[model samples]
Target: METRIDEIGPGIYRLSTYVADIAPPAGFTFNQFLLLGDEPLLFHTGLRRMFPGIHAAMARVMDPARLRWITFGHVEADECGAMNEWLRVAPQAQVAHGRTGCFVSLNDLADRAPRPLADGETIDLGNGKRVSYLDTPHVPHGWEAGLFFEESSGTLLCGDLFTQLGNGSTLTDGDIVGPAIAAEDMFRSSSLNPNMGATIRRLADLQPQRLALMHGPSFEGDAAAALMALAADYDQRLKAA
Candidate 1:
């Protein structure tokens, strides 16, 4: 698979999966990430089917076998389907889980130990770059979820948050590619599931500049305000209901 990579910010690139032709649901197609750091971190694996693209994208930064950490928010296939592959390629890479629950679940799946991460945990990516974990369980789906904010660049690696439909070339919230529409669609999808609103509240309080979605472009601007809008809107809906 020939993946299209776009540099969304310094050291960050949006990797477009070649499988868009197969028509995956929103937040389920590809991955957006930063790879030029000393110890690069990948937020999500596109899918089992997109491992080739994922692999190729990683190779662009270094040998696919050299990544130090493979971090993920959830245990879903789209988020972690390529775990075995990553373990195969990057033998020394540790699987970073947002919570102890996630570490246990993933251990059961891959028969490999996981590096448990909690809120406020920080992984040094070297060269003054580090990604801090912010636990936000059940935002889109519950199962030990969290977001990573790259301290050096101020980019929030939000998983399954601020996602949208369509496979566009540019990937960022400030790209005029439809942040409000995407935010509403994301709210609607997550609202159908219980417990996600709590995560939204946490995100509102933990503000970041960029909201990088796995399936679509990253959302930029005042992330705190954007997240507050989401949290407030969701709260109002629940009250009305």
Candidate 2:
């Protein structure tokens, strides 16, 4: 599997790897986002086995050792399986996540101590690139789940929010909510709690211009509307449940 790199937003690069064997027929894509700045940050470490390809893909744009912050949506293999690997390579990099994530897993899992972020906390990457973290406990899955929003580019580094199957375009303005719902039906990946819709609606309030998704193609244009639609779907699902 070859990892493809694309700049989904200003200073934000997406490294996508498509594996055909995972889901058969259509396959699945594991994506990671690299945000460059004075202090470069990498969201999602992919899998530990995928480090080589993702590392090479990242080196094409910037040195992997330059990474300053390592983070993910939650404590999952696909989300942060290569966390220690990254810390080993980028000596200066620290794992930053919500306080619960750090306390529950990262404190013992990380090779080095991690920096705990409070809800709505912002990390300045310098060069006008700032990312704010918001706790989204169990919205998607894990109690430690969270996401980041890049202020400068209006890009939301959404983790597993709009997860869809197949390796589609690197970026699209088309319908992602539909594909995401289909995937949700197939995998039942989300937590599906009453607060799920409300938490997602909170993200919609960000009015993100771009959504940097973890599983499928990154989306551009009318992100808030797409988010609302997804929220509505979750609400309906909760009612059905």
Model 1, global lDDT: 0.69
lDDT of 1 by residue, 168-236 (tens): 546444543245445555456553334556667676666577777786666677887777666665566
What is candidate 2's lDDT per residue for 192-220, written digit by digit as tens?
Answer: 88799899999999999999999999999
Residue 205 of model 2 has an lDDT of 98
Clashes of 1: 2
All candidates' TM-scores? 0.84, 0.99
Evaluate candidate 2 by giving its C-alpha RMSD to the native, one decimal: 0.6
As a whole number from 0 to 100, the lDDT of residue 72 in candidate 1 is: 77
Ten residues in sequence with the least summed lDDT for candidate 2 = 3-12
The positional error of residue 17 in candidate 1, measured at the CA in angstroms, is 1.4
Give the residue spans of candidate 1 off by over 4 A: 18-29, 173-188, 191-198
Q: State residue 135's C-alpha deviation in candidate 2, in Å.
A: 0.3
Q: TM-score of predicted model 2? A: 0.99
> Each prediction's Cα RMSD?
3.2, 0.6
